[model samples]
Target: MVAIDANEVSKRYGTLQAVDRVDLTVEEGETFGFLGPNGAGKSTFINMLLDFVKPSHGSVSLFGNDCQGEGVAARSRIGVLPEGYSTFDRLTGRQHVEYAIRSKAADDDPIDVLDRVGIREAADRKASGYSKGMAQRLVLGMALVGEPDLLLLDEPTTGLDPNGAAEIREILREENERGATVFFSSHILEQVEAVCDRVAILQDGELVALDTIEGLRETMGGGTKLVITLDRLEDGTLETIWAVEGVDTAVATEESTVEITCTNDAKMDVIVALHEAGLDVLNFRTEEASLEDMFVEYTGAGR
Candidate 1:
């Protein structure tokens, strides 16, 4: 069964079209990543999925239930960590978790949930006195209370330290393993790259690219970039490097270093050719194009 589905989904406010006509599907048991820069309508689309904001046109379904008509049923199976989520200032951290448990009719222990988020010690403190990161953790723990079939996390790691972010990633992995479908939405590429099965990039409120990471690299004509540091550059080195099979572009970045963008099969050949030319190969490294690079290319952000 598809975990989440949207057809021709669009949202408009006055003269502004927040989300353009877009179709999306996320399969069950997969960790799908939704990526876009700020104001790209990611949050708007998420709101539509949760029925918090009605779409101007199109339909959405959660776990095969009409999200709008069957709002209660659709939402009952989902846990959400919304962007800029605010907790009651008077409630202690433990109270927040307990409230979620009561709402879901779940038998979860508040202490256990707090421990999972690494905020157990802060459980007795009121939210009004909590740090931003601590408040984020408390809300995240609330999301975990019912162990819902789907998790909708919007910038889940915001305000978190590196260590805290890592902890959240680990928790996501555990939840996915327990048969929950995760929809992770973030503008940060590195965070999603580590855990997502497939990614969709939204540009200007339109779906620009949707593919596996490897497929995206191919679409962008982005292959591995090999940088070779050598003792010296030979007279015919550039020409020979270009002639190598699978080599796309070769240029000298420094007096003694050459950068070559080529397929994996051609990387070793370039090194051998340089060695045969009597140049001492000091060191070499390979760099892969990241999702951020592809996002920039597709959105024309780099232009």
Candidate 2:
């Protein structure tokens, strides 16, 4: 089932276009990542989908119904963890979530939802006293309380530590397994690569790329980087290294180190050639190009 669909959605602010013509569809039971650099219109596009911001052109549909035409009926079936969500400072975490559920008229147990987000112990603490990460968790807990069919998370792990980030990823994975579509936006390319089934990359308010993680890697020319440590520097090393058919580029370092970048299929060939060059190679290791590098190459920025 198509949980979310945006066709030729366009949003503009005066003369500047925030979200240019774009098309996106998220299937049920999949984690679809909306990826882009800052000011790339990711949040604007998401806001249009949520009907928080109306589009200048085109339309957005949720669960086969037009999102913009409805009176919160479609919205009731979806939950959102919006970017920069703020809660009442005086209210405790538990109260915040319960209040959201009540306001939404959702039928769910707030306690169980809070526990699922690993914020049970902090539920009694005031929102003003919560850490940045904890505040994020509380809002997410509120989003889950509705048990909606789809979840829209914008930079959901921005304030989380490594462990909290991993925990949230796992929870989203479990939610996907249980048949909820997760439409998420994040500047963290590695997180998208690790958790998302498919991704759409926007640049300068335009959809520049869309595909599976592996497919995007292929499109970006997947490669492995090799860093070789030598016992001592050698003369004519650059020329000798370039002699290997598959070595794309090589840079020699002052500390007797050379770094070679090549495709995966060409790595072993380059390694063997390095061994035969009469150079005392102390050690060698291969580093693969991560999704982060691919994102930078495509989006022209990193977060």
Candidate 3:
């Protein structure tokens, strides 16, 4: 079964098209990433999926049930850590997880959920006294109740420290391994890159790019990094490499290595060119473009 299906989905407010005709499908058990800048309609799209915001046009279905028409049926086994989630001022961490357990009719231990999100020690503290990061963890713990079949997280790492973020990523990995379909939405490229099987990029409320990270890199001019280790280097060696047909940029990084950004087809040609120039090639490798590179090229965010 398709985990999520959004067909020509659109949401408009006044003169603004918050989401414009986005067509997307996420297969069951797939870890999918949804990325966009702030106000790129990511949250709006998510709201539509959860039936919290009605789509102005089109339809969305979850597990073969129309999200808006059959809200409870569509979302029964789904868990969500929504954007702008807040903790109740009086509820302790344990109480929040317990509430989710009760809501889901699950038998999960509250302390176990708190421990998984790395806040077991603070489980007894009132959420009002928790820091921003702690509150984020509390919500995530709530989302993990019932061993949900689908996890829809919006900016899951918001307000987390580096260690806390790492913990969340690890938890996501565990969730996916246990057969849950993870629909992760965040602007933190690295987090998405770490766990997502495929990613879709939205820009200005339109779907601009959708593919695996490597696939997106290929679309964006083969942003591959080629590093060549030579027996020695000379002043004109880099200039010679830059003159190659597919080499984009070449720089001497060390006494014996030249790192080049070039097309995928140029990697071997670069080594051949160096050998022809009386240089002994010792080692060479190519690294695919970073997710950040793809994000910048496609969305022009953080440019």
Candidate 4:
């Protein structure tokens, strides 16, 4: 069964359009990433999927159930670590997990769940005294209570240290292995790249790009980049570099460095051209575009 399906879904508030018409679908057991800049309507779209915010137009469904018309049934199949979730300050860590267990009618032990989230030692500590990271982990533990079919995590690593973030990644892998689909949205591009099978990039309330990392690189063209530091750059140096048959783009940096995007086969040609132009090659290296790189390219957020 499809884990999520949205057709021409959109949301508007007053004169602002938060999410434009967007069509998206995720397969069962898939690890999908949703990305967008601040105020780009990512959260609005997610809230629509949860039926927390009604759409201005179009429809969305969860596991074949219309989220708007059947909100409870749709929610039953998903576990969400929502953005800006509040923990009950009067409850202890264990109490929170136990509440979720009871709410889901699951037989999971609260202590076991707390231990799995690395908060076993603080199970009796009131949430009012928990650190931000601790509170984050508590909510994640609550989400894991019943082993729901879909895990919708929004900025799951927000306050985590490196070790804590790594632990979350491991937990996600474990859940996906156990047949749960993961719909992850985060600003941490590296973490998303580490686990997601495919990613969709949103901009200005529109779906701008959707593909696997490599597929995005291919679609963007010249996935390989060459950073060449030269002794000095003369006039038309960039144009000379761009003249190379396979080069897609060439730009001269402030420090006499030339950045070029070209096919892997064109790497050597760029260097030879610099030498032929009488510019001494100081240093050069090739790197494939990272998710962060593509995110910048797609969203125009880089400066």
lDDT of each: 0.89, 0.81, 0.88, 0.89
Candidate ranking (lDDT, best to worst): 4, 1, 3, 2
What TM-score goes with each of the models? 0.82, 0.81, 0.81, 0.88
Candidate with more favorable, higher lDDT: 1 or 2: 1
Best model number under TM-score: 4
Q: Judging by TM-score, tell me the better candidate of 1 and 3.
A: 1
User: Candidate 1, residues 110-226: lDDT per residue as tens digits?
Assistant: 999999999999999999999999998999999998899999999999999999999999999999999999998987788898999999988888999999988987875656878
Top-lDDT candidate index: 4
In angstroms, give how far residue 281 of model 1 lies from its true place. 15
* RMSD (Å) of each candidate, 1 decimal: 5.2, 4.5, 5.3, 3.1
Q: What would the TM-score be for candidate 4 when compared with the true structure? A: 0.88
> For model 3, how does the per-residue alpha-carbon lDDT over 99-191 read when each residue is reduced to its tens digit?
999999999999989998889999889999999999988998899999988999999999998888998999999999999999989888898
The whole-model C-alpha lDDT of candidate 1 against the native structure comes to: 0.89
Name the lDDT value of residue 40 in candidate 3. 92
Candidate 3 ranges with C-alpha deviation above 4 Å: 225-287, 301-303
Residue 120 displacement (Å), model 1: 0.5
> Comparing candidate 1 with candidate 2, which one achieves the higher TM-score?
1
User: Lowest-lDDT window of 10 residues in candidate 4?
Assistant: 294-303
Compared to the true structure, candidate 1 yields what TM-score? 0.82
